[model samples]
Every structure is written in structure tokens, then in C-alpha cells.
Target: MIAQLARKIRYIADPAFDTRDGYGGKLVIALRDGTFIERTEPYHWGSPELPISAHDIYDKFEANTAASHLVGNVGKIISMIAALEDVGRVGDIVELCRREQD
Candidate 1:
């Protein structure tokens, strides 16, 4: 999988890359035939142009929490976050993120 990803990926660095325009950084991919493809503005998930689905957010939350070895019911944490608007206190979320004692 790593090899396949490496083969399809390209990276370019520009010393003048800037995001002061609020459009994020630019990405340019130069082709072998001398032409290139470019994106002047970056797409941010959950933004007006590019919106992320709830499932995707939950997937990311699960992946990050698992990788961090956080001790709690991940499903419950996700539920709490999803319903954060109705939550009376923010400390409830903090309690769920506490490390479990061994």
C-alpha cells in the first residue's frame, strides 16, 4: 500500500507559498510533457465550497481517538460531540477524554 501511494504521489515546494488571501495555498503538479495542472485555492472540508459528511467526521474522530489510546467509549464520545449544541456543560466532553487508570 505504501509503495502504491508513493508511486502516485508528487510533492512540490515553493519558497513563496502564502495563504494571506484566505484561499489557502496553491498546488501545482508539473507533467512530463511540460504542461502542468494547478489549483490556485485549497479546499477545506466543512467549508462553503467543500463540506464534510457526518460519517467522515465520525470516522476521523474514531481514528484519532484510537491512535491516541484515549480511554472511553468512543461511540459515546462521538455522540456527545454530535449533540454538543444540546449539551449543558462542556466538561462532560472533557470527562470522556480522561485517561483510564491501569
Candidate 2:
């Protein structure tokens, strides 16, 4: 099930995510060639159930110098995906994979 979710979110491959660390905070999700799609906490999230938007999550990644060049890539990728949302490929892949999820 996790694998299916991960694959479905592969459109945002290997992007870093912003997370609150004990001391300060950390830019998480580096190794995997995919985006992080975890639910946000109620305290930090506006909706509790669906606080974070896909685009907001993408924006949290740390910019260039160390990791991938995330300076402007976030918006660029989001725009790219937005343009494709009405298309069939992403939906088809997600629907097909979701059928196998258990």
C-alpha cells in the first residue's frame, strides 16, 4: 500500500520536505526518488484532516547549494503537473495501481 502511494506520487520525484525538528527544523525526504505525501498534524494544519496542499508541500524543500536545485523547481514542477492534471496519464496510472492496493 505504501509502495502504491509512493509510486502514485512519483510525479514529484526526490523532492525534499520541510519538517520541524527538535532543535530547529530539517528538510526531509532526500533519498527516495519521489515526493512525500504524509498527512500533516492537526496542530500545524489548518484542516487537520487535509492541511497541506500538494503545492505547499513541494514549496517546503530547501533550495540549492547542497541538495538538488530546488530554488525555483518547486513551482515549475507544480505548474507542469497542474497542466497535466486534466490529462489521462497520471489518473490512469494512479487508478490502475490503486486497484492493486490492499
Candidate 3:
């Protein structure tokens, strides 16, 4: 999948390709075998009735924090936020989010 994504990016980056006016909320892909797939709904899991799971949210949080490397206490932050209802004070979580000195 990663390789395929890289290939697609390369194809898009090619100067010969026409990429103007590419903005769109829908995705339509046409295969070489004369088949195509399309999706019009922008947020599949963003609806209130179909909210994202805690695990999925955590996965996204972890990915963002890891990529940015801006947070030193990710685990503590995740735990604090997960149990925010039981937490005595929100400052405790804020304190844990402080960046560590090198």
C-alpha cells in the first residue's frame, strides 16, 4: 500500500500531469480494467451517530505526536484525557504536557 501511494505521489508530481483545479470533496478512481470507484460522503466516521472509537482517536493522537516529536509525555497525556471525568483537576494533565529539557 505504501509503495502504491508513493507511486501515485510520483505520478502526481510529474510535470506532464495536469493538476490544476483539483479541489474536490469527492474521490473518483478509474481503473485500467474499465472499472471505477467513487465516494461522495466526505466524513464516513465523523457523524455523531458514527463517532470514531477511542482506539482510533488514540492511534491518530499517537501518530501526530510521534511525527511532530513535540510532546514528551504522550502516554500520560492520553491516560489523563481518557480519564478526564475522574480527574480532580485539569491542571495535572497540563503539567504533564510540559516539554522536557535536553
The per-prediction tally of clashing pairs is 0, 1, 0
Show the lowest summed lDDT stretch of 10 residues, model 2. Answer: 18-27
TM-score of 2: 0.26
**CA lDDT of 91 in candidate 2?**
58
Q: What is the per-residue lDDT of model 3 for residues 1-102, given as tens digits with 9 covering 90 to 100?
A: 999876764222433323342322455577889897976543346456357899889888888889554456788789889999989999988777666668
Better of 1 and 2 by TM-score: 1
Residue-level error in angstroms, candidate 3, position 47:
1.5
What's the CA RMSD for each of the models? 4.4, 16.6, 7.3
**Order of all candidates by lDDT, from best down to worst?**
1, 3, 2
Candidate 1 least-lDDT 10 residues: 14-23
Off by over 4 Å in 1: 1-11, 15-18, 21-41
In order, what lDDT does every prediction score?
0.74, 0.45, 0.67
**How do all models score by TM-score?**
0.56, 0.26, 0.56
Better of 2 and 3 by TM-score: 3
